[model samples]
Target: MTASEPGTPRTGPHRAELDLDGVRDEPTFLDRCARDLALPQWFGHNWDALDDCLRDLSWWGRPSGYEIRIRGWQRFRAAAPETARTAADVLADAIEYWAPRDTPLTVTFDDQE
Candidate 1:
């Protein structure tokens, strides 16, 4: 049964929601993820570090899955296209890594203004 199916226990699909309303740089992006996602102290504030943390969310709790929803990134993408691409690539890799695992990972970008 799917997660939303009735009678299914809410063991989870733990979520981390990030609102980047005014953020437009790599530092801010990393800082936002580290702060909003409650990344561990070992997080090194870099793309590699972000990738590592996204792949290992055991610290966030052992949920059935994970969903990272990002909103208000149009401005960031417009301001820093390269950085946004890199961030997207890392997130995509994390999703792929978890797709075949028991605990899946998903990232959604909300383009609503």
Candidate 2:
């Protein structure tokens, strides 16, 4: 089970090839998350917010960050749908509030040494 691009119609194979930097992985983040969490597969509509959060912070390598955030958010939402909704609302508001800031946002992972 995999989440197709949000709002994009899916037909054909249950799995689709993700054109990553170059490598093709068998199970995409959406696929694995749906399988592991047993949630109705749905592409995250808030992908852009998640992507910006990741890129600004430079967490995992870009590829890994995409996978982690997508999967993590899916799992989170599945576990607590209400909380997820609240989080999404907060994130949206934050983006609007922060948009006018002149300084670039920076995110750092403490785990990185």
Candidate 3:
């Protein structure tokens, strides 16, 4: 799964790329998500917090749609399969939450490093 990065600024309104090139644990994964996704300041940096933020991206003015591209995730998955599954599930849930509301949220994976 891959998509070209838009020419827009790396602010809250464009696709957020989380490059987990070396991330191998939940803590690092959370930190990478916070930085790459530009999560809100009030973000609690936890699984629950991540779910809440992804569900409501008001911080980004709740764009008409949202896309998240995950790159270099192979290492993380191999290092910690369980956490990787949980992370994928959370993202999937976020997509489900937005689909019914008309605001599509797509999560793509790009492990071709």
Candidate 4:
């Protein structure tokens, strides 16, 4: 049965992809984020800025219950483990930021490349 089928439960997370191939610096990471999420021009390309935009994703008009998957996550991790950890933490923060509303937003790092 399809997701829209009446009997099918709406229990799955919406999937989005963020490519991190050859992204080894802050600027590239920010650019990738902006492109992946189609963030606004006001994004400041910093962690706090990222957090702000992430929390404000209602502008995308996307429904609740979504998990954005960062593809080639291992590339980022290999190039800069600390930065990768920071990204993961920020995503976790975003998840928490929306949890109170029962939106079920989250992110997953996929190392499959």
lDDT of model 1, residue 103: 80
Q: Once superposed on the true structure, which residue ranges of model 1 sit more than 4 Å away at CA?
A: 1-10
Best-to-worst ranking by lDDT:
1, 3, 4, 2
Of models 3 and 4, which has the larger TM-score?
A: 3
Candidate 2 residues lying further than 4 Å off, grouped into runs, are 1-71, 104-113
What TM-score number comes out for model 2?
0.31
lDDT of 4 at 49: 94
Residue-wise lDDT of candidate 4 within 1-113, one digit each (tens)?
A: 12134553454455668899989977888889998878889999999999998888755554546668888888788898888888888888999977876456877777856
Local lDDT at 86 for model 3 = 96
Candidates' TM-scores?
0.87, 0.31, 0.84, 0.80
Task: Give me the displacement of residue 36 in model 2, in angstroms.
Answer: 24
> By lDDT, who's the top model here?
1
Please say which candidate is ahead in lDDT: 1 or 4.
Answer: 1
Task: Pick the winner on lDDT between candidates 2 and 4.
Answer: 4
Which stretches of model 3 miss by more than 4 angstroms? 1-13
Model 1 lDDT at residue 70: 93
State the displacement of the C-alpha of residue 86, model 4, in Å, after optimal TM-score superposition: 1.6
What residue pairs clash in candidate 3, if any at all? none
Error of 3 at 68 (Å): 0.3
Give each prediction's root-mean-square deviation over alpha carbons: 4.6, 17.1, 6.9, 5.7
